[model samples]
Target: MSIDAPYATLDPDRVLDAVTACGLWPDGRLLALNSYENRVWQVGLEETSPVIAKFYRPHRWSDAAILEEHAFAQELAEAEIPVVAPLPFGGRTLLHHDGFRYALTPRRGGRAPSLESTEQLEWLGRLIARIHSIGARQPFEHRGRLDRATLIAKPMQAVLSSTLLPSSLHAAYRAAAERVDRAVADRFEAVGPIRQLRLHGDCHPGNVLWTDAGPHFVDLDDARMGPAVQDLWMLANDEKAMSALLDGYQQMRDFDFGELALMPALRAMRQLHYAGWIAERWHDPAFPAAFPFAGEARWWEQHIADLHELSEELT
Candidate 1:
């Protein structure tokens, strides 16, 4: 669990030992292992219900994020928001094991849809509106806001600083980074105050779980206070999808059209962030093809082209 310890090779026996120590299940078959930055597993025993075990990466995630998520989950539960509830383990919101921190939560019964239908998209919009409304009334602080600069710097820095990626990707990464930076800078300067608010940060289809209650959002790991439009842009990267989601969102919350116009560029920048991260972590095959730069450069080229098209429409 030391930072120097090889994180890629986790000991299954040690993880099972940790499970037993937690008093949940000493002997249960590890059902599935998810390839995330953090260690995740589906643990189940015949006598008891199944649950998810998440081991946090030390130094990678801030303690504030862990605490904030627990607090936010509790607040949402109190408000009857259909979100995953985080359970306290090891007398702390986060549990320490093998030099790393971990948290456990009961796995809800449902799966995320690959694509959001019109009705589902509308429901998602309303749900987000409600979350924003509730979050607005609460006193909270985020590590930082998502501006053009932060969106550009974090990924660029990650790409440049990462030792995992090869030298061949450096030039392509820098060029893409510069393109995103320029686009964001020009777009932000033209538009003022693109409606900042508490956002889920990552609202892609993967994070949404469809349950009997409706769409329930999980994996609030990236939740933070940022531009309200950020979530919208993240969800609606394509015109058809954006229109559907926006139609759904507008039904619940009042928003300005001006901010909607900025979504394409915002989304393009967001895509670049993921792309750069994937390039750094490309050695790992779990990176999704949906994000920019993960596949051929043509995908990113099209995204940049879309940004240009959106800019003309906005003007």
Candidate 2:
């Protein structure tokens, strides 16, 4: 199988078969979920609630790392936190079917939480704090970290190698990236020592599902070690929203205000990382289909402009 087209052979049959192997009979209804790094599906079952089956991206994470994520989610769920944890089949959460590693989770349904809602923001903040409390108990043995090198340098490299980035803009892109890199490093150094714990590394409104029961946290795929603010910033769009979030967070856990300074750096890093990810994954057909704008040279120009703006904002 080609590394670029990792999902080439993952047809509907394979998806259903993987689910059936988990001792669950599929009702032939398969719906693809909105995921790129990993393939996810909502598989209806025989007279039972549907299950969310996740097929991990090829070579992205090791068995140990994936298990750690599963264990963390299970821990959160066991603590009465609303986390969508893997449903262990025959005492194993991670299962294999024809070279594809997959796991079954109960299909959870909810609309995107309104980050604009102060009540929801505070509520989500408290839940995030609880997640961090559990996350602090121990560090991940095999998972990744949310740092400059891991998030910035590597993604920048990927962006550099992408053919999608026009050669004409190469020099400008590199210069902007370098400036952003230095600024991120300076910000990290300025922040001094940080208290990093396992975090929901990609904490945004989209990852949170809002229902009457409040919120349900899904997709811990990007879970990593980082400061508490990494989980808070994406959910709070403004200063007032951040204050509300912090108010709720402080009710459950003490938040270091110093980490707020890292927000600009984080935002810049995210921007770079997103571009890098799209570049690296452009080999996959789904990326091109989903991000048609990226194929245009104009988009790269805009991306370069944004990077420069981020660099200036940080500096």
Candidate 3:
């Protein structure tokens, strides 16, 4: 018979066992957090502070790539940047248990940052500028780069080959996806050679946490080398908000305003990649339940229309 499921193997007992192996006593408390790419839990300790355990998805990343992610977090912490870095246990950052590679980090609690406040937006801008400054200092050897091939081509191929797209919509999706792909390529070419640096990769609002002290970044799992704009554009909801962010960014470092032109193309690529990501992970039990919209025909129709709209803007 087939196995139960992918994450079903990661039972509470296994989660606790993973923590106990690290020389910590669990208090029988485990809360599954909001993560789909990986299994993350907040385990309460007997006497010590609680910690968040992130179990890597099987075969998702190699040891070297995971180490590079840890190294980047450690580097940011050393620079006095407020980032949730993985705690070193027994002089090691990554530990393997029951065929799962995991890392432990101290628990950090905070609400989402207030994007509406100019002060808050500027604060984040300054923090991101510092991150980019350090990111430009070095490069990742093992991790992948965020480019057209990884974001567009691979995702397009995956969607076309998979049964995720209904037969009726396949032609429309293919045509729109190809148009968006070409538009993205042309936009990148028009922008010319932009600086590529080690980035937090996914810098949306959910990834940032706000406290009385300030904002601190969490979850560098998606960390990779990409343009500075990739990190900045997602946070901005409008031109005024973007200007406010740039106002602060320019204070700490030189802002490349030309990157603004690539925003439309970047947004289109992310939209295309998201569908492919869901389709690729559809076999996972969590995907269908979590993303119910992906199962419907209307959603795919809207997606095609959105793609065409994005393509129009890119042209």
TM-score leader: 2
Per-residue lDDT over 1-315 for candidate 2, one digit per residue giving the tens place of the 0 to 100 score: 579799999999999999988778999999999999999999999999999999999889999999999999999999999999999988999999999998999998999988788888889889999999999999998997998888889988998888998999899999989999999999999999999899989988888998888899999999999999999999888999999999899899999999999999999999999999999999988999999999899998998999889988887
Candidate 1 achieves a global lDDT of 0.66
Rank candidates by TM-score, best first.
Answer: 2, 3, 1
Model 2, residue 121: distance off in Å is 1.0
User: Candidate 2 vs candidate 3: which has greater lDDT?
Assistant: 2
Q: Rank the candidates by lDDT, best first.
A: 2, 3, 1
lDDT of 2 at 304: 90
- In model 1, which range of ten residues has the least summed lDDT? 285-294
- Backbone clashes under 3 angstroms, per model: 1, 0, 0
Worst 10 residues of 2 by lDDT: 113-122
Clashing pairs in 2: none
> Number of clashing pairs, model 3?
0
- The top-ranked prediction according to lDDT is 2
* Whole-model lDDT values for every prediction: 0.66, 0.92, 0.91
Summing lDDT over every window of 10 consecutive residues in candidate 3, give the lowest-scoring window.
1-10
Off by over 4 Å in 3: 1-4
